[model samples]
Target: MKYFIYAVITIVGIAVIAGFFIVGSPGLQRLRRLDETRISDLQSIQSEVIFYWQSKEKLPAKLEDLTDQVRGYKAPSDPETNLSYEYEIKGEKTFALCANFSLSLGPEGNNAAIPIPARGYSKPGFAEVNWNWEHTEGRSCFERTIDADYFPLIKDQKTP
Candidate 1:
């Protein structure tokens, strides 16, 4: 039954190839999901800080300063690690936010995601303050600055 043996080997080979993809996809998907969550968490924190600056005319001393019972907003933490995101005030108008990312922002060895635009703040002189969200595997941080002259424009818009 040489033909039967060959058929069995062919089926087994096909099954093995299929199995690899089926088993491997979930792990990759989970990593991508975690990366998306990390991006979302950073965006949330950025918005809160911008809102705080607009309302108070100064940067919050720490991330906790954005927590307010009246607004029902609480600082977000890492989705997979359950650790608090990193924050540091570099200047009166500058701050940095950091997170541990599980995957590269794009294909390997390519910094395709550099200079991600800071959504919602579009004033002419204030354009430079938009934070960059580019990152690689492991820990990455984004720097931001607030131009106080545009604070009035921020006030006119509702908190996102």
Candidate 2:
């Protein structure tokens, strides 16, 4: 009888330990939430970047240039560190948005920031512009090139 009680107690303890590992600790969960916020901030900035390009027919030289008081456009920085996110123009229309992530988003693309890469969201006579936004743990960057057809130099200009 004594041995049976010990076995049952041991089993219960093991289960509790396993549950913590599966669900993760509270601190870890908090970090994940912060990463999600970072992703959201990046998405908002991306939209503004595209708009800036479309309106000006050129990409902004710096992220700071994205802000407009009338448009209420305010670029966001890192959530945890409260630092500016990394941005660079790779070419005429190509650019990269970078951030440091706490956890790895599986290759399955679960909860991807922008899963729709090259998505066709433009009006008629435009090519796809959106791109997939996925990342792994640690520092990562998402590179995208503006599609000229989708975003012509002239605002509201449709392809023939």
Candidate 3:
């Protein structure tokens, strides 16, 4: 009788643990994955914009302007809709990148990515997570400003 009770307890424990993850819902998980992709794309666009600003001392007029064959860099589009991300130049050194997200990410950008996956799960650390990427569901825009001191214009230094 004791062995039977032990088996029941172990099964119940496993079920409870499994239920916790099941509640997360497969569809919801997919949405989260899409949002993750959106964030990643935005980060890439942001880097490209900053680099352009540093080189030209101004924001690109449009996303296409950031594409560089020499650097082998191309602007990424929305993963779910396969549409171009919205880009708007707000000022000489400021621009906004917009995309639609299916779900809201946690404050720390999906802190639940700790446990190892079947292959190996990895969560972004503090330095990896951009503080500006936080957004609610639906359309969100990340506006960036280029600092002149930090991203100075590239000028050819002429030797006298």
The numbered model that scores best in TM-score is: 2
TM-score of each candidate structure, all chains considered together:
0.70, 0.73, 0.71
Better of 1 and 2 by TM-score: 2
Q: Candidate 1, which segments miss by more than 4 Å at Cα?
A: 1-24, 107-118, 122-131, 153-160
Instruction: Evaluate model 1: give its TM-score.
Output: 0.70
Q: Tell how far residue 112 is off in model 2, in angstroms.
A: 9.1
Name every residue pair that clashes in candidate 1.
none
Decreasing TM-score order of the candidates = 2, 3, 1
| Comparison by lDDT, 1 against 2, better one | 2
Model 2 score (lDDT): 0.78
* Backbone clashes in model 3: 1
| Evaluation by TM-score, superior candidate among 1 and 3 | 3
Residue lDDT tens for model 2, 28-141 = 777778777877888888878888898897889999999899988889999889899999999989989999988766475333432323333657655544566568887889
For model 3, which pairs clash? Answer: 117-121
User: Tens digit of lDDT per residue, candidate 3, span 1-160?
Assistant: 9999999999999998797686666777677778777777887888788778877867888889999999999999999899999999888787888998786654644434522122111233312223356676788887877766544566732336
